[model samples]
Target chain A: MAGVAAEYFLEAIVIKPIRLRGKIKNGIAEVKALLPHPMETGARVDSEGALVPAHYIEEVVCQRNGEMVLRAEWGASVSKDPYFSFKLHNSTVGDKITISWTDNLGDTATGDITLA
Target chain B: MHRRALVKGLATLLSLGLLPLNLYARAVAAFTAEQAADVYRELFGSAAILPSDRIHIKAPEIAENGAVVPITVSTDLANTQSISVVIDENPNPLSGTFYLTEDSAPEFSLRVKMGRSSTIRALVRTADGVYMSGRQVKVTIGGCGG
Candidate 1:
């Protein structure tokens, strides 16, 4: 084949961990999370005055029991140690909740919660 | 040939139809969009966003530090498909966008950075149309720019 001998490229993946916290109160399931990330803006200088590369979470996805609830597209403008809070209506206790995110550099993590 | 087998194996998946949904969530261009107007353009495509009382944006009137500013956005509009936030002074003003489903309310709380004093615009996309609201935030110190 013409392209049979073409070089193959391998992709590497990195998995991070996410911490989740939330509680259901008054029939509303309020969920929030703190994502520990550097959230570099790519425009900042290091202590040595060298430009720091941009590294930040680009997307956040939340779901309830395998169904999508909230999906977010984020940029580098998010502050360091990004955190978010969202509410779920029509959801009851013991429903499984999942939160996940992928960064600009492709680092990803998933966090899980069960309503209490 | 090895290449032929590789190509054939890749196409053998029967679940190809669900691929679009996976790709839709990874739109990097919209996240990197520099201007708020460009972001809205990509969503509405020349359609005007109406000023609405249904959308609400809550943010501190003055931020002591630009690194982290707390903001909350909620909307009363029904059937909201998405909610987005834009900071007028940031280099990439389109801070983020949220796509919601029936299980969740059209409200979220997040922290973002501000380069300077700016207007925080929150928009909601519903079946009826696009509606938005804006709140001013004064920054005593500018956030580090990228």
Candidate 2:
């Protein structure tokens, strides 16, 4: 119950936001996703020269038609507000694609699109 | 009705293990050079990380926004298995690791958050267990705390 409350709050605040789009062409689907994040490396100093704590996306999962297409492990090296694109073959016009990301802080967000 | 079916389908997918549980788990907060080397060891086994010009890293010499720096890694190497990116100056050096299938092209593009000016390194592993890398990308931070 304790963990459940925090989980709900994290989802409610939406620290990770994603924008996803997909299109089908020649039996393949091209997907593009934009994710906004701080991706803090915990090395930078604040105005007072205090080191910021580490915060970055840890993993990104992409699913096509309910099947896992890609899983990415990301560290602090990825730039903030990351963008990604990939292709899926043998996909139809109406196949569903979902992209989800989890950060080091355990916050998560998801975006999905149906191929057109 | 459609929403119900989608929910059920997601449940099925979860049961089938189509989703990676690690995505929901917390990740390492920071990765030092030693830890980055360990990650390489775990992935490449005894494969030596050799420097090669085959892998190409395309990034701006100066990033307008440290929060979202665009990068591309492309290679002409055959039988490529995977590619990984590293940032030399970031608190955590290892940024991304991509596994490419035979059908997948040996190229990838993505945006990452950087803390400051840094060198971007792209490493590619071929199917023959040989590890090759591209040149460093000098990223000048225009934003962030830098």
Candidate 3:
């Protein structure tokens, strides 16, 4: 068996808020976020005989124009790609929604979507 | 030559015996208590969580597959701030966490992945300073040897 460190490539990836239809009905603003992460559990080994360290996104926060709206804390139980959906109150068509997250490895990702 | 053949046969049996042992070892490596506590602290800041009836967590008693589990958390508290779901025996205890604002209602739902049979806990923090929690859900494997 290979070492864990050499088993896989670790990259920090972020998604800029992509607008999706059906998120808003009437006045409530619904937002969905998809973050790219490997969520490694630090248990697996690579072909290079290295032990892969556990790396996963630990915190997620969603804000509407500097106002804290939603927040989440996750662990390795989350899947490879983490997706979150939330609803914002009294949001109009021009409000900005910001979603940010920090991984266990200190990697951070942020995405923003404009309410329409 | 006969002695050598006997030794080889014994070696083969020993190897076969080791195979099942290895499989069992992997199965038991799914989750640990220390890992669960780590996840709990990361989410709640401490393991001394007080269980409250204000939060109601809905989940299937026995999950057919360990891969996908559907969980719903609802609270009667006004101005609920956040809701979190945790699996006590999963490799990673923290499953899903949701932060709710005054604009949103007090109920939220989501799907989480489970690596094996474990206890799921939901914690709810209201707009006030008090913290409340719900009960544990027992998840079981259906067909997937989870």
Candidate 4:
């Protein structure tokens, strides 16, 4: 098992902590995403009793088959390690789904998937 | 062993395929109309939220884990321009906002942290300069990171 400090470090510097899953069902595309983030509200204290600055994903964008499908804005209130799912109409199997997010601290991550 | 058990439990729950439809009942108790309106004023610089049923929100009635409450908002209304989600009882009431394009759908889903049982509100803006609002989702857990 990893210590809490290691876990925090992993969350801070880790790359591509996002997992995107896309599936076509009955002519509609279902997309599910799992994003691991501290989403630190900056209101919490660290083990050293120091305030952790606000670090959160501020924006998320999704593209389907090279076309923009969705966009989202987030804040510190979002949970650590968030999950989201939505449906896209007029999509089919073998199409591509791409997701990207940018945090407040200027960290960004991207993940892509092929619908099956 | 404990981590293994937890993983197994989550896998079982996921396999059951019930993660998508977690919303059970509607619980509206955290914020009053007045408070929610005040939050609206603070965010948009006005208190002109027109109540409309076109906007829809799907969320769990009782979030066992307040730290991560899943919420989905969608609407079929035409000319929708923007959407904003708010947690009325949080220290900062405004949660997030989405700017929409003509080609974009008027829907999205995300997770939010709730400091306590509070009302989740979605405010939508249309192209005609009219603001349409949806119903409030009541969260029963205090998921404050503080």
Q: Give the winner by TM-score.
A: 1
Kindly list the per-residue Cα lDDT of model 1 for residues A1-116, writing each as its tens digit.
23221221222223346778888877789998998887888788665556666778888888899987788888888888898999998878899999988776555778898998
TM-score against truth, every candidate: 0.84, 0.72, 0.64, 0.72
Query: Can you write out model 3's per-residue Cα lDDT over B73-118, one digit (the tens) per residue?
Result: 7778777766767676665466666666677656655556666667
Interface RMSD of 3: 10.6
TM-score of 3: 0.64
TM-score, first chain, each model: 0.83, 0.83, 0.78, 0.85
Clashes of each: 1, 7, 8, 0
Listed per prediction, chain B TM-scores read 0.80, 0.68, 0.63, 0.67
State candidate 4's TM-score.
0.72
Worst 10 residues of 4 chain A by lDDT: A1-10
Best by DockQ: 1
- Across B54-132, the per-residue lDDT of candidate 1 in tens digits comes to 8889899999899999999999899999898989778888888888988788988999999999999998889888898
Supply candidate 4's per-residue lDDT for B93.
67
Model 3 lDDT per residue over A1-116, tens place:
34445324533234344333326678888676667666666664555557767777777777777777776666566655665555666878877788777666445667777777
Per-residue lDDT of candidate 2, residues B1-146 (tens digit): 45346657766787899966533332233344435566566556677888777778888887767777888888888877767887765555677876665544566689866667777778787866555564444445544454
lDDT winner between 2 and 4, please give it: 4
* DockQ ranking from best candidate downward: 1, 2, 4, 3
> What tens digits encode model 4's per-residue C-alpha lDDT throughout B1-146?
45346556765786798565222211112212236556566555654677778888888887877788888988877888778888777777667777666645577788888777777788887765445554445566577754
DockQ of each: 0.48, 0.30, 0.18, 0.24
CAPRI rating of model 3: incorrect
Flag regions of model 4 displaced more than 4 Å. Answer: A1-16, B1-47, B102-104, B132-141
State the displacement of the C-alpha of residue B96, model 4, in Å, after optimal TM-score superposition: 1.8
